[model samples]
Target: MIDLNNIEEVIKEEKKILRNKSKNYKENFFEIKNFIEKEILHIETLKKNGINIIPEINFKDLSPSLIEFKKEVKNRGCVVIRDVFDDNLIHQMNKDLESYIDENNYYEDQKKKSDIDKYFSDLKSGKPQIFGLYWSKTQVNIRQSNELNHVKKWLNKLWVNKHNNQTIFDPNNELVYADRVRRREPGDTTLGLSPHCDAGSVERWIDKGYQSVYENIFADNFIEYNPFNASYRNETQEIESAAVSHVFRTFQGWVALTEQGPGDGTLQLIPIAKSMAFILTRALMDDVDDNDLCGSKPARALSVNSTYHSLLLRGLVSIPKMNPGDTVWWHPDVVHAVEDQHLGKGYSNVVYVGSTPYCDKNLAYAKKQSKKFLEGKSPPDFAAEDYEVNYKNRAEISDLTPLGKKQLTL
Candidate 1:
C-alpha cells in the first residue's frame, strides 16, 4: 500500500517504476509531443473555418445516427445533446427548485455557515455558484426521468466495456450519482474555474489501477492509448477527499435549466479527445521534478494551467449557447472550465448529472447513497451538509417513480 503521509516518497518510487516500464521515456515523450502538435493544428483549422469544436446533436436524431454520433464524441471528447427533455417540464422543474430554496430559507442558512467544502474556494463569485442542496423534488424527478436515463445509457455505451470476454460494466442500466446544482445570477462576476480534470489528481500517476488504464501511454505507445477503454477505470481508487467522486462516471454532465451561451459563464473545454496522453507523457519528461506530477496533489482536482499545459490550452473553446432542457457531456479526462463572468440578463442554472453506469464500484456507492437519500442527507461523495433533512417538499420514497427507485437502488 502507498503511504499518503509520505507522498513525496511515494511519488519518487512511482516515477521510477513507470520509467522502468517505459524503458525509453525520451522517445515516448517525443511521440506524444508530435501527436499533440498535430491535434492543435487541427483544432486551429476548425476554428478558422468558424466551426464550433464541441459537437452538438439533437436527441431526436440520436437513434438513427448513433454510429456517427459516437465517432464525433470520441474525436472531440465532449458534446451537447439538444432537446433531451421537454422544455415545459424543465421550466417547471426550475420553478419548483426556486420555490424549494425560498421556502427553506436556503440563502439565509448558507450565509450563517462557514465554507464546509473547499473544492471551489479558489473561485471568486458574488455568491455561491454551487449549492449543496440535493434531494429536492425537482432534482429527484429529473434523475428518474426516462428520457434522461435513456440518454445516460447511450453515453455509457461510448466506452468499451468488454475485454478478454469479461464485461466490465453494464451500459444499459444507468445509476444515480446524486450531485449538487449551480445557479449563477445575471451580471455574475465570478473568476470561474480554471482548467482541470476531476475524479482523481496524483492518483492517476501513482495508483496501480490508473497505471493499468494508461499502460499504453506508459509503454511508449501513446498513439494507441484509447481513453474510452474501460479496462481498469472502475478499479482505480482516489485518496479520500470530499472533492473526489467515488463512483465511476463514464461522462460528467449537466442538464441546463435556463438559456445561456458563451460569455454567460458557460463551459469551455480543450476539445481534443486524445490529449490525455500528452498530459501523462509531459509529467514523465526530464523537466518535471521526480517528486511532482505537474502540480497534482492528493484530495484536489487535477489542474491544467498555462505554466505546464500551454499547448493543450491552445484548443480551449467555449460551448455554444444552450437552451433549457439541453445537456452537455464530457469525457472524464477532458480538461474543462467555466467562463469568468455571466454577461447575460438571466440566471444560468443547471442540475448536475453524470453518466454513471451499473458496475460493482458504482453499485456500492449507490447503496450508500440510497440511505442518505432516505434520510435527506448529502450523498456519500459530497460534504455532509444535510441541507434538505427537514426542508419542505423534499422528495420522499412515495415521490419516486419505479425507474427512480431502481436508479437510486432504493
Candidate 2:
C-alpha cells in the first residue's frame, strides 16, 4: 500500500523528527524558566528572614557540596572548582596534543605564515582571522563535537543532581554549541580576547526566555532572592526572544585537562555574578560609583554594581594556579580573561561549553555553523587559527578516523 521509493514518504517520515524537535524546544526553554523563577523566590525568603546564603563546595561528597556551591554561585552569580577532571586522562591528552603541534611545526605564529602581526592585527579591527595551527588529530577527536555530547551530558547531569535530582535539560533535546580549543605555549599572547559580553548581552535586551534567569532582579523587591525555586527555568514571560530555533547558551564552560599554573595560563573569574550583571546592565545609566548598586556587598569587601566593580573585577580575576584534571566554570555575566602563558613551558587546554538558550536567533547561528563545520570553517565568534590545520586540509581529516569522523563528515 506504501510507495517505498517515494520522496513524499521520506518527507512524511521527517515530519516526525520535526515534531520531536519542537518538544525539545519547549523543554529547553522551560528548563531555564523554571530554574530562575524558583531560585529568585527562594532567595527572597532568605532575605525576609535575615539569613546568609553562601555555601562552600568541597570534593569529598559532590552532591551536597555542589548544591551549596551552586547557591553561592547564584548569589555571587558564578563559581569555579579546581580538579574536576581525571589527571591521568589529561596527561595523556596533553601528551598527544603536544606531539601533534610539534610534529606539524605549527606554532601560534605559523597560521599567520609566521606573520604574527599580519594575522593578529586583524583581531583588533574586529575581524575574524586565526593564523595559528588549527588541525590536530587530538583536537578533532577529543576537543570538537566528538566530545561535545559526552561533556554536555556530564554537565547536564551535574545540573540535575545539583538541583535535587530534577532532570534539567533533556540530553536528547536539540542544543547548539559555540566552542573552541587551543594550545597556548609559553608567552602566547596571541589568543587575547578583550573584555566583552558574549553575543553583546543579547539575553538581557531581547531574549525574554533568558531574561527569566534574572527575573528576581527585575522584581521591585530585592529581598526576595530565592535560592531553590524551579520557576527560573519554566515560567513564561513576555519577550521578543529570538525564535530562530537555536540555542545563546545558558552556560559557558571548559575542561582544563592540563596542569597549567598561575603564569601558565590557567583561568580567572570575577566572583560576583548578580552585581556584575546589574552593573553591566546599568553601565550607561550613570558615571556614579557602582559600589552603591546591589543589595549589600558580601562579607568580602566588594562593590554591588558599578565601574568601581571593574577595579575589583581586576583583583578577583585571578588564575588559581591549577593542576592537571581541573575543570573551571564561570558565568557569562562576569568578566573573564586568560593570563598569557609566560612560564617556560605550560598549557591551558580546554573544551568550551555554554548556556545557550534554545531559540530562533541561535538557530540561525547554528545553521551557519553547520555549514562551517562541513567546509572546515570556524564557527561564528570562534577565534581563528585555533584549528587552522583542520581548515586548510579537510581532505586529510576526511580520511583519518578522528572521533566521530563519519558523523561529522556527513
Q: Give the alpha-carbon lDDT of every model.
A: 0.86, 0.43
Candidate 1: the clashing residue pairs are none
- TM-score against native, each model: 0.96, 0.56
lDDT score at residue 287, model 1, on the 0-100 scale: 86
- Predicted candidate 2 versus true structure: per-residue lDDT over 306-401, tens digit per residue: 333333333334445456655555554555555543463855666554644334444555566556565555554443433443433333436435
Off by over 4 Å in 2: 1-66, 76-85, 102-135, 143-178, 187-196, 201-247, 288-308, 311-315, 340-345, 355-368, 383-410
lDDT of 1 by residue, 10-109 (tens): 9989988988888798888888888888889998998889887788989877773568768989988899999998899999999999999999999887
Give candidate 2's whole-model lDDT.
Answer: 0.43
Residue 74 shift from truth in candidate 2, angstroms: 3.1
Assess the local accuracy of residue 341 in candidate 1 as a C-alpha lDDT between 0 and 100. Answer: 85
lDDT of 1 at 343: 91
Clashes of 1: 0
